[model samples]
Target chain A: EPEVTQTPSHQVTQMGQEVILRCVPISNHLYFYWYRQILGQKVEFLVSFYNNEISEKSEIFDDQFSVERPDGSNFTLKIRSTKLEDSAMYFCASSDQYNQPQHFGDGTRLSIL
Target chain B: EDKVVQSPLSLVVHEGDTVTLNCSYEVTNFRSLLWYKQEKKAPTFLFMLTSSGIEKKSGRLSSILDKKELFSILNITATQTGDSAVYLCAVYISSGSARQLTFGSGTQLTVLP
Candidate 1:
């Protein structure tokens, strides 16, 4: 079965540096989403992208976060300035339709120090 | 505020035992309920139910949604050690042309030999 895939399975970055987490959604998917989970915490929604624009975002998705669909299959989340609290497992998910089940990537573990 | 609550945060069982995980949600617009299995990385989709009282099943796992009560349950029978993982329940909210998902803290299931 086709699945969402993310690059840089794990990343370590300085506290003030910028980080980009990349994802290649399923080829035919139309909606993409980003979610994060702090260690031992519930997964939280960050943002959703469709038609090259952000469709929805959570309060946690503040000024530092941005999402881009630079290409047909690539969906990326960029954090302008990382904070220690930003360290978490970032996941990418995609769905073919609005209300369908989303398929998720293995996730990129972001570690800030 | 939208919320998903899962009961009995952690469970331990032996192989061949059966287990049930519960999830309840309070949201503005309910679209669907989903179940996922997480083991060390991203969550893998297991089931999605849109209508109430209709059960969806795959292998030894089955789920049913109760729209009237705003709850759902996931059952696993004859479990194996490989079944040890965090089971997450998420609800999709639809409003106008937009949709978002809220996830629960998840139930951690440990199946021992």
Candidate 2:
């Protein structure tokens, strides 16, 4: 079974530094999404992308956060300035169509120092 | 705000025992519900439920949605140690041209050998 893959399983960065999390969604999947899970909190949606543009984003996806599909296979989430609160497991997910089940990647654990 | 709530945050059972996890939600323009199993890194897809009454099953795990009552249940029978994991429930809601998932806190299941 084809699956979504994320790079840098664990990332550690300084508080004021920039960080970029990368994901390669299933080859044929169209819709892509980004979510985060704080250590003991529920997984929270960050943004959704389709047709090469951001379809929707949560309040947590503020000025510091941005997503880009730089190429056909890579989806990247960039945080301009990291903070302690930004430390979490960032997950990438994709679905083939609308209302379909979105498959998740193993996740990138971001740790801010 | 759209919310998904799961009951029994934690559970422990011996092998061969049966267990059921509950999820309830309150949201507008409900699209679908999904169940996932999280062991350590990622959440693996389990099932997706859209209509009520009809059950989606795989092996010893089964799930059903109750659209009218706004709840869903996942059942695992004759469980094994491998079945131990955090079960997450999420609801999809239509948001303009996009949709996002709202996840529950998840139920942690521990199956003892």
Best candidate per DockQ, number? 2
DockQ scores for all predicted structures:
0.82, 0.89
Q: Candidate 2 clashing pairs? A: none
Give the Å error, residue B69, model 1.
1.3
Residue B113 alpha-carbon offset, candidate 1, angstroms: 0.9
Error of 1 at A29 (Å): 0.4
Estimate TM-scores for all models.
0.98, 0.99
Model 1 lDDT per residue over B34-103, tens place:
9999998879999999999999999999999999999999999999999999999999987666577799
lDDT, residue B82, candidate 1: 97
Tens digit of per-residue lDDT, candidate 2, span B1-113: 78899999999999999999999999988999999999998899999898999999999999999998999999999999999999999999988879888999999999999
Q: State the fraction of real interface contacts model 2 keeps.
A: 0.89
What lDDT score goes with residue B6 in model 2? 98
Tens digit per residue, CA lDDT, model 1, A1-113 = 89899999999999999999999999999999999999989999998888899888999999999999887779999999999999999999999988889899999999999
